[model samples]
Target: MIPTVVWGTGNVGRAAIRAVDAHPKLQLAAVLVHQPAKVGRDAGELAGLDRSLGVSATDDVGAVLAAGHRAVVYAASGDVRPDEALADVVRAVRAGAVVVSPALYPLYDHRNAPAEFRDPVRAAVEEGGGSLFASGVDPGWGNDVLPLLVSGLGSVVDGIRCQEIFDYSTYEQEESVRYLVGMGQPMDYVPPMLIESVPTMVWGGQVRMMARALGVELDGIRETLERRPLESTVRTRTMGEFAAGTQGAVRFEVQGIVGGEPRIVIEHVTRIHPSCAPDWPVPPDGSGAHRVIVEGRPRIEVTVEASDEGENRSAGGNATAVGRLVGAIDWLVEAEPGLYDALDVPLRPAVGRLGRNQKEEERA
Candidate 1:
């Protein structure tokens, strides 16, 4: 297996670095970073590992790519800089690196992606002779892989609903929470995430992917949203305070219409405070969870709750997304070069991890 270069040192990038370093087959070749201050830091420090991983972070993208790393975990934040992220992934693939990322939303299900989003990546993959796959928590395994796998357990399937119930207080990205998602915006202000066809553009592909996997034809896609304002001012540990009458909670659904009904759905129930949305769903056992519920026959439901140190729900979700990308490196290396989505990239079996914990114990 070719070593992996982890690009970006954000939430997802940090997880990807740790995942690649700990994997039995993969090695962390380099940590690509944009910040000059992080240029020479050890990979372990960036990823919060106990000891240094020999690889150092670098700002020189080309030099790192040319260093013979066969794969890159492109974990840069896509919410704000999608085009930049896409261009970087394109360059990595063209540089002969198989790329796996959650950055490019359109490529999560490249089959349904618009031409503006899919065409360039397709062409780049064809030219580079390297594979590209994009996925994330909500649009990644939660909706596509988990739901379709659960569908097999049911004798008669009516509707498949995938839900991500999370509290965003610990989520550190301030700009995103305040503006992009409109978490604490005034009630009159429309959150960018729920405005117009944004939800469809972001999540419709997941619905379509699930439908395709279940052999169900979708007639169309629809979206619905609801928001709740804070009864009084409340402060969060990370993103500061929200004044009274501002947006505090939001529930939205991206529905896949089947025979004029919303059959396959990807729904989100998010809040700044746990108390805001009492009626809305919460993770059964923890602060957050990704759940897949089948509405038919036996009525099967599966809930996934992951936790890292400090019980950070956001980190858990980030780790899952990283694993989905890094674990697929072996498969991606052998698959035909092109743009792939979760549907094309099946969930891989657990790669037996060794040598990491023992080292940690020794250091401690």
Candidate 2:
């Protein structure tokens, strides 16, 4: 059996723990936490599992490494500390552990990522004779792999577009909602510089992955971010009240270019309340949906209505991505090592089946 260490005690970390707990070939050996308050607690209790797994949560990374685990799942913070987390992954790889991470920037924005972020991890993994793989849901499936799947139906291709529309009210992550919806920020808060260069930071890699897969050399990418004040108070499980007239809705559009011409456009919207913008197209379900459109010999469009469970139920897009990563770990471990994006991964029904069965078994 593969002994695994899970890093972080957050939403994705908890999900990873549950997934690792259920895998027949994997054992939850340890959990590493940065918070002093979480250290030395039962891993199961930390993950809301009433039963103990014989593993304890600790702030000691070295101790966990010394325990002789074969793999580590890095499900820590995805925002500001991603680079640091990647460094930790490199350390684990150097210590002879395969690493699977759901960090956002590394998996999608590899080409333009800072040397400090990418180089050390690459060097460490190579030197240690280990491998690292990163993936999530949006860039993983909706934009990256879905377009690749659609490409199978045609010979020539013109352009590709992917979109995700979801209600932010039900999402339980305050930081995610604030980040995506631009809440509690000035309308003029010129989005972070990284966002401007790479199309709003949320779906940059999705566009890049599609362009690369189709052999279309992109000249540049452009982004447009817009938001409006919320008309009424919005409530979420995490955030009780987003006061009326606050900056609570956001719409982001990214366009990919080839020789100064727009070839592909990807759009994403996160709203705290429903139908905030009537002019924009909304999914029929009002929950959340992913749509992909391919322009080629025979133009084809496919739309998937994801269930409001697992990651989709809360935490915005990150949760869904986390779920995808947890589900794919079984097959991903055996795949050849390299930088893999969503297009490189397969979405098999069996993975979902396994996840559901595991959850059911846990309850039993």
Query: Local distance difference test, per candidate?
Result: 0.84, 0.69
List the candidate 1 regions with Cα displacement exceeding 4 Å.
354-364
Candidate achieving the largest TM-score: 1
Give each model a TM-score.
Answer: 0.95, 0.84
lDDT of 2 at 351: 42
Which numbered prediction scores highest in lDDT against the true structure? 1
Weakest lDDT window of 10 consecutive positions for candidate 2 = 307-316
Tens-digit lDDT string for candidate 2 (132-204): 6676545356767777888788887787778877777776556756754456455554434225654545566
Give per-residue CA lDDT, model 1, range 315-358, as digits (tens): 78888878888999988988888888887877867746544543
Give me the runs in candidate 2 sitting further than 4 Å from their true place.
Answer: 48-54, 109-113, 137-139, 179-181, 190-195, 198-202, 307-312, 315-320, 327-338, 343-364
Q: Supply the global lDDT for candidate 2.
A: 0.69
